[model samples]
Target chain A: MSDAALRSPLHAEHVALGATLVPFAGWEMPVRYTGDIAEHTAVRTAAGLFDLSHMGEISVRGDGAAAFLDHALVGRMSAVGLWGAKYTMMCTPEGGVIDDLIVYRRDWDHFIIVANAANKDTVIAELGARLAGFDAALEDVSAEIALIAVQGPRAEEIVARMCVRGDDDIHAMRYYTAANILLTGDIHAFAARTGYTGEDGFELFVAADQAAAVWELALAEGAGDGLVPCGLSARDSLRLEAGMPLYGQELTRDTTPFDAGLGRIVAFGTAANPRGAFVGRDALLRAKAAGPARVLVGLVGDGRRAARTGYAVTDDAGTQVGTVTSGAPSPTLGRPIAMAYVPPALSAPGTVVGIDVRGRREDMTVVALPFYSRAS
Target chain B: MATVPEELAYSAEHEWVSGDTDAGVVVTVGITEHAAEALGDIVYVEAPRVGDTVVAGEVCGELESTKAVSELYSPVSGVVTAVNEALERAPEAINADAYGDGWIFKVELSESATDLLDAEAYAASVA
Candidate 1:
């Protein structure tokens, strides 16, 4: 490993478990423990534990926090109920996405913004600059915090077994809601029913020093339930299968929320309870009026030749229409699935399109977003 | 650590060639276990057509893992005599057993390649 590579608090644990560590977004994180396929299948079938300490967290709080976030983020932050989390985006003045983040309304005045690891510094700087007129205070709490996630059908069962304190009725907790939970030894942690794997999972935010204990406890409790320690590779395939857009891949500075079919995040013209004003509101409103030229869609087909990132998307006649952003062989679906941006006409489900896999164009049928969704 | 058989001659590109060079060298070519392990899971394997002439250290086909795609380079100049047809339907065989059942193709070596690495040297390079 490079000397400058940042190590997660659970780095030693990953090494002890014989994990394959890879440099990801400047952090020396585990990419796989046993293998990608096994770990991916474990999450889908049973349970999987993840060391996501590398992901960035920023705490924003003050009297003007709600008003400040509304103007800064694309979503209506003030509208989110207390202890609720909402998927939102922060965009530039021209409406180009700066980063896609989840805002957790912790209280009446405090909120926590979770950004992608790679975009942490950028998001912090952007938030600092945007806090000029507002009285909100922003703090980058990434290094001080460690995130551990337990995802799958057995997630709640395993998590409940390890909890020595806090919210006894955690099984009844609603999705997108967070509660502070204490584990054995009075380990203070915040548990949220949120995850990236498109499963019923919980993300636990704990102190950096307590990461290993939480990880080991979850793994020990989940051992009989077939909970395996998963890595970024499996997490990626899981998210891709769920049709979630990655920060650097599907969302970029050149791509707007509307272009990515995420215009619902932009708060505009909702007179019922309008979010007074926000950055990029005018541009987003204009984009809404003119409709996006291209939109994101899900593509599925047989065969192992996956249409990887940057692969060209073409019509049946071989004319280029768009490009693929993320793709992989779906472990659950037993075929190759991908997400791409294509013309609105070709974005409809069942529309046949050709994916230029290398030089050869392979036939793929456009499908609805989210190749797999767990039963509610 | 991935296994590197002593009976096979290795290449810098992580290809293992198994055959004798005394007579007309008939060699079976496959990617090393190290390459397969690094690739995570093999989802696609593109093999050269039978009877296709390939140059030493040149690209012959490609291997697609679940994460990324990599070019497969021929170790020595030869004509591909046989290609592994079974890999088309089951590419994960390479990840399961990279050397034995996963041999990519068979080649009739035209001439002895001087740049071929022995097992010790090849292992050292990867190590």
Candidate 2:
């Protein structure tokens, strides 16, 4: 395919900034602007802006929207109020995860779901097929909506300055909530207080044609705070340090939500359960009761040698136990960290293991999730 | 991208080979600017220890960036005489100054391994 086929709205801006562009999820996204460590440190200490338009957004509207989503997703749909967002998953009947997504209640009868870019088509098809019997309308709005994520310590202040209506009081917005703001005459944009960097941030959804203008505004307003344009390389490092799971890496069609250590998102017997008959409920309940055979755990390596994806996890005696799902030399921690799945017996914190990186063995220690958490 | 140093000979695999025949045919090896650009950012580097024997086209080290890990192949056969100790503390120097203080290892060539590319040839190969 031609390179023009996958260019995003900010392609020219990225090139002008001397970004290293790479193919990611069918889109030509910047892997790093200037350098990875610089961008990573910028997000940790100051602020960073990201062009996230490649993410898929699908909307479900109608009277049965809530019921349909409750039956289709793993999280409790009824508990979320209008303008509330919940991180949830769509799983297969055998309890394997199809995709982990965020569901936003746009209104009483409208819901918007955002999914990974690579899995957009599959997610839409599956949702449509499942909701065919229900009274709801499903539409794919990925091509029409553009997203920009402003993240870091000063993200809210920067956004407040760019927005015409709201003051810095928007900074008071709690996490996982979204509000609509009128940036100009009759031009409304939705801003969600959510992020993957484990920092205070907002994701703004705007019309496709207005994306570049909004990005320019955010950059101008945030320049004084040391806001730089971040790319996929820094994005990976930041999220890895925050212990957030990437869809294909940490969750996949063959991996169950329970096995991925996301049982808290599943509401089976709660009062807010709109799940009359959701997919994977039975198998998930059984797995929850009996406990998953394997669980995902965080690992910290002894040195700078990173244990990459697909590296084998083994005991000191060389018995193969699990495989690494995602690993990197964390820019923030200045050491190698990873996430992997091991047998239940070896999933506890402080379990000593070795990662077979190529032909060499690197010592590692199993640790709790969220290697770094934002101070409350 | 950083400038390719004119004094150094380069290999098709993007490694720089610099040395003098007067100094017992000793050559210092490091990755090129183009290689560092493609790798994005340097995170970890595992160099062969001093006195370890290496053959041409053999893996002598490993370089890990934020995106992926790649094996560093030796351009000539030799025994490792010196290894970069600074990489253990600050590997990003490879991304910053690939040709100078970021040199990875030094080797005393067994017989002056031939067929190594020059800077122009190496640049053409990458282009």
Candidate 3:
């Protein structure tokens, strides 16, 4: 580990759990505890804990918060209900993705924007610069908060068990919503029904100083629900199977939401829902008119060899057509799956393409975005 | 601390070979526990074929894991005499026991293997 790498508030807890620590986005975080496949399977069948403190949480407060967000991001933030959450994105003036974000409406004039760890500073700077004309304040509360996620099929029961109050709220909570809850140590937390894993889960925002206590409480209460602490590997596989685009991988400064097939998140103003001008509104409007040059699509390999990131997507005649962004051997699907950027002509499901996995060619078929989805 | 068998020889590439380096004798080969743990769960193993000639300090196969894929190098030059075919269906056997049932392949030494490190020296280097 590098000397300059930062540590999470739950660092000692992770070490006590014998987690494999890795430096990611400047933070020394747990990549896994027991094993990747095991923790992945646990989330699918039972429960898994995740320390997401490395993610950036910035607070936006003041009367103009919602309007400012609606102007700064490609979403109708003003339309989000109280205690509601919306998955949105910030972009450059050129319609390129800056970072995908999840904004929580904590109150009428208070909101929280969670951003990717690596892009935290950049997002803060951009948000700060955009606040020139708005009556809002931006404060990075990432250091004050520690995020703990309990995700999976049994997550509800496990998280409910840790709460001293709000069990009924936990049981009655809706997805993409947040609730204020009190835990075993009388610690107040902002718990949200949101997660990167496709499974049903909750993300608890607690005080950084009490992070270990909350972690232990959840572990103790969830012992019966098989809540094993997971790492980045399982989290990556889970999010990939859910077809969620990762910031650095699937979404980049060069790619627009339209290219990633996530234009729905960009709510452009129209005659009826006349939203104010937001960042990238003009360029994204142009992008919508011209259509994406390369469309993001999912692929399933026909062979055992996986098509990894940067692998060339080739045509039948051995011509390079696209590039793979993220890939893995899906533990749930028992096959190699990947997300790649290909032309609109080859983006349809069942379109056959070849991947240059190392020196050999592995045939992959275009599939729908998600290779795996939980049963509702 | 990772387990390092005293009777084995190791390569900088993390492959462990049976102690004997005399020419014309077959030597068993597998990755050390240190390597397996560092690689996370081994999902797939691509061992050199039984007839393929593997050169020391050269990449001959691959070990694909959950997080990343690593090249498997031959510690000693030889023809692959045998391979652990059981790994095809149960690659996690490497993570379960990298030195025992996880032994990847056996090779008939084509020449005396040179520059092989003893268990103690290899352990110190990794440490």
Candidate 4:
């Protein structure tokens, strides 16, 4: 395909900044600006701006939006208060994950689901097929909306400086909540405090045309605070350090949320907040009752030879037990770290495992998720 | 654009050969500037050590970056005479100055090497 076919709204800006453009999730996105380790460290120490316009945005409107989502998704969407966001998943009837999504309640009967870039079409198709008999309409607004994230330690301060209205509301905006806020130069945006980097950050949802404007504005406003325009490479390492799962890697079509230790997002009806039948509820319940066959855990390697995706995770007996989903030299930890699914028996925090790092046995210790966590 | 020095012999694999190419002459070897820029921030590198024999156009070591790990290929077949020990703690030197402090190893050629590309030809091949 041509480069124009997948260019984001901020494509020009990235090019001007000398970003390394690469094909990712069908979009020609910047893999890095300046350098990987440098940008990753900037995000950890200060702030980093990311153009996430490639992510898919699907909207559900009409009175049955809440009910439709409850039936279509694994989590109880009806329980999400207005303007509140819930991290959830949509699964096939067989309990396999279709895509992990964030459902943001816009009104009493409207919601916006942000799906991963590559999974957007699949998610939209699934949501549409499951929308029968509900008073709702589904639309893919990924082209109309642009998603940009400012994430890091100084993210809040930088984002707070751009508010034209509701500055206090921006500051007081609770995590996982969304609101229509006015920004510098009279730009209107639906902003959220949600981020994948495990930092204090804000994700701005704006019109596609205004994306570059907001991006440039943020870069200029955040220049003093040491915010740099980061690319996908830094974003990947940051998310890995945060112990979040990337859809294609950790959460695939064959992997269940329960297997990834994200069963909490899979809601079963409780007496206090009773939920109706949802897709994959029965299959997920079966998965829950049977327990996870494999568990996802963090692995911290001793040497610089980092484990990579598709590398075999081995037992002490040299048996191939599992596969690494994501691995890298973490900029925060200053060591090699990885996330892999291993047998439940060996998933303890201190259990020793072996990763075949390019035919070499590199020993790693199993640790809890999120190898690095920031102060709240 | 990354610089491809005209004085050095180039290999299609992007390694540069320096010094005398005569048989039994210890020639210096390092990755070209273009290769270093493409690899991003190199965190670790494993170059063939002294006494290890490496073959031309064959895998000899590894150059690991945060993004990916690439296999390093020897530009000339020979016995490794010396390896850059400074890279053990400072792999970023390769990215910072690919043709200088980044020279990975020195190989005493088993025989005079043949079929190496000139700077112009090597640049065109990559382009």
What DockQ do you compute for every candidate structure? 0.65, 0.71, 0.73, 0.78
For residues A20-70, what per-residue lDDT tens digits would candidate 1 score against the true structure?
A: 899999999999888888999999999999999999999999999999998
- TM-scores of chain B, in order: 0.96, 0.93, 0.98, 0.97
Candidate 3 local lDDT, A171-201, one digit each (tens): 9999999999999899999999999999999
Interface RMSD for each predicted structure: 1.3, 1.2, 0.9, 0.7
Instruction: Evaluate residue B28 in candidate 1 and report its C-alpha lDDT on the 0 to 100 scale.
Output: 91
Candidate 1 stretches with Cα past 4 Å from truth are none
Query: Model 4: per-residue lDDT, tens digit, A245-346?
Result: 999899997999999999999989889868889999899999999999999999999888899999999998889999999999887888999999999999
Extract clashing residue pairs from model 4.
Answer: none
Docking class of 2: medium
lDDT of 1 by residue, B1-127 (tens): 8899998889999999887743357889999999998888887898899999987899999998767788899998888999989999888889888898899998888888778899999999999
DockQ score for model 2, please?
0.71
Per model, how many backbone clashes are there?
0, 0, 1, 0
Q: Give the TM-score of candidate 1.
A: 0.96
Q: Write the per-residue lDDT of candidate 3 for residues B2-117, one digit (tens) a residue.
A: 79999999999999998589999999999999999888888989999999999999998999887888999999998999999999999999999989999999999999998899
Candidate 3 regions exceeding 4 Å error are none
Isolated chain A TM-score, each model: 0.98, 0.97, 0.99, 0.98
Best by DockQ: 4
Candidate 3 lands at a TM-score of: 0.99
Q: Give residue A121's lDDT in candidate 1 (0 to 100).
A: 99
Please identify which of the two predictions, 3 or 4, would achieve the higher lDDT against the true structure. Answer: 3
> Which one wins by TM-score: 1 or 3?
3
True contacts kept of each: 0.52, 0.64, 0.44, 0.56
Q: Once model 3 is optimally superposed onto the true structure by TM-score, how far is the C-alpha of residue B38 displaced, in angstroms?
A: 1.4
